[model samples]
Target: MAEPTTSSRRPGPGAGSPAVTTPALERTRRRFLRRQRARRWLAWRVVLATVVGLAGVVGACWLLFFSQFLSVAGVEVRGTSHLSPEEVVAVAGIPTGEPLARIDLDRVESRVGSLAAVRSVAVSRAWPDEILVEVEERVAIAVVELGGRLRGMDADGVVFRDFAQPPRALPRITTDTVTRREALTEGARVIAALPGSISRSVDHVEVRTVDQISLVLGDGRRVEWGSAEQSGIKARVLPALLQREARTYDVSVPGQPTTK
Candidate 1:
């Protein structure tokens, strides 16, 4: 009976023990996997949504950035003295309803400056639908009669108008009848280089040579300014010299003032 009392039991470790993962553990692992998969899916959704939003923004910008929704509708003129708006517009070459992207300010300014009346030019954009053009006209200082044509000269070495009939108010420039641009340029400089006081007091200027500049004042006095150089020094001494000196004074030499 004692021999037959031994049971069929095996070892200490049991298969159903909680030492290793089983069906219940597998169920817990499945739940964990499901949660991880849900997180991965959410991350993908976020990535996709961001990509879609960026694509939409780029598409909208591409569709609208330069679609020509607005064009040049008007023109504005400023700082103009002699040239008319129509004349400036004609030189600008900006057609009505032109796309703003096509308007080149440099080209427009260059074209406009070709006009004889325009001494200087500044062109700019006036917002999305307008253009602003500023022009400075040649200030007429004298008219030179040459070869049966009266040629106008400004104070800035620029000769512009040629008149068959001279204007009444224009001062007469009686010098060599040479109509070359260089000569005219010299005439313009002669007119333009005078100081405000000298210009106001003087009636006419004669440029006989490069350095021989003579001016006739309002009171019938003569001024023989040698050249346009040392203008500041000459100007400084002019008031005192004219006060003490005779009817004629020459201040072309900066350090020396000669009176006649």
Candidate 2:
């Protein structure tokens, strides 16, 4: 007589659990899915940005170096008086249509400075397409006759240009072909030191040797300058000495000047 056995079996794991989802669990799952999608989008964005940056860099390099946008167009010369602009440009030899950034400015300056008339030169890029060459020409302080031709001599004793006719304003120095270069230099120094007040009265300078220099006035008076030494003192003393009536004035020893 046993009571009807009620067989009871244990439920398997999750077999009988309700098919239910809580709000928090559902929200967590959505967040995880959104995180995965966010990671994928971030990766794509990073790749796109990297590609764009590389393209910009490559484009800039091409424009600066390889392109013809910055090539030289022409050369302009300035501060040139005795030398024509064409002469300076010819000697500069700067190639046209070449890359302006690649031109050697130092070389250009050296070439232009080689001209005897150019005392100094500066070369620079005028940007966009031009090259500028500035030349400083030598200024003649005196004139000399060499080989039957009148030549201009700068203050430094450099004989640069030949004059077709003698300049009436510049004081002429008498030096033959056989005259020593030292004598020419000394004579030039002496002439440069004279003040305009005294120099204007001089007709010509006589250069016998390096130490022997004399200034002959228009009225036939002779000034024994002796040498270039103490020239400043001599220059100052001579102005006062000239006020006296004398055929010859000696300022060789400025402290003990003599007039006869």
Candidate 3:
């Protein structure tokens, strides 16, 4: 070596001398680089795992719910009167073999209640394989002319059905006095309260105001019932009174009977 020169550049934060390498320091730096690379690899692996797990979860859920695995096995009905079971089911349009998860309850109810006989309908899931349908039927009490058609009425004057001809057993309620609805309402309630035997005997009923109410019997006799309220009681007592009189009896006072 020539003359030994003093170093111009002082050691930085890590470098100490040029000739002697610090093996412990170099090992520490090398270890740090290795750890940094390992951290990057671990982060990449986590991202890849998250992406794959999301894909698998989506695939599994799609296979379970969307697949039509379960179906409507049976349909049960209650509260049906005039409407047949087959007709009610046909209106429901509930698809067989369709998944129960997708069962449209509102759609089914709206369909079946379209029949005139069905006043309201309710649907419930019976679990696993069946659906239950409960319906409220429209009671047929009498038929009255509505808009030139014979419309059916219940005990509450609700006109549900319009047919060309009235049913055989149901009474024909008629009036020429402009066919007032208030009279029909009062008549329906009064008719519903009468005894079954007496109510059934009425062939024709008229709602021609308080003074001119009339009833034609099946026995070729006429009753002079003055009003709808008293007529209900008259119906209950008319048979006994008729036996005594043999002619028309005004049982409007209910307990008192006068022959006509």
Which is superior by TM-score, 1 or 3?
1
Whose TM-score is greatest here? 2
Q: Once superposed on the true structure, which residue ranges of model 1 sit more than 4 Å away at CA?
A: 1-68, 141-152, 161-172, 178-187, 243-248
Question: Best by lDDT, which number?
Answer: 2
Residue-by-residue lDDT tens digits, candidate 3, 1-260? 79998989867666564555699988998999999999999999999999999999897666544665556777898888767788888888888777665788988999887877887899988766677899999887888886688988888878887767778888888878575777787667666766777767888877776455667777767777766676656777877776774557676677777877
Q: TM-score per candidate, in order?
A: 0.67, 0.78, 0.56
Candidate 3 differs from the real structure by a C-alpha RMSD in angstroms, to one decimal, of 8.5
Give the per-residue lDDT digits (tens) of candidate 2, residues 1-260.
Answer: 88888769866568776667899999999999999999999999999999999999898677655678988899999998889999999999998888887889999988988899989999999988899998889998889998888999988888899999878789999966678998999999999999998888889999988888999998999999998999999999998899999999999889999999
Clashing pairs in 1: 155-192, 157-188
- Candidate that beats the other on lDDT, 1 or 3, i.e. the better one: 3
lDDT of each: 0.75, 0.90, 0.77
Off by over 4 Å in 3: 1-67, 71-81, 84-111, 162-167, 209-212, 226-232, 244-248, 255-257
Please give the TM-score that candidate 3 achieves against the real structure.
0.56
Query: Order of all candidates by TM-score, from best down to worst?
Result: 2, 1, 3
Worst 10 residues of 2 by lDDT: 10-19
Candidate 1, 109: how far from true, in Å?
2.0
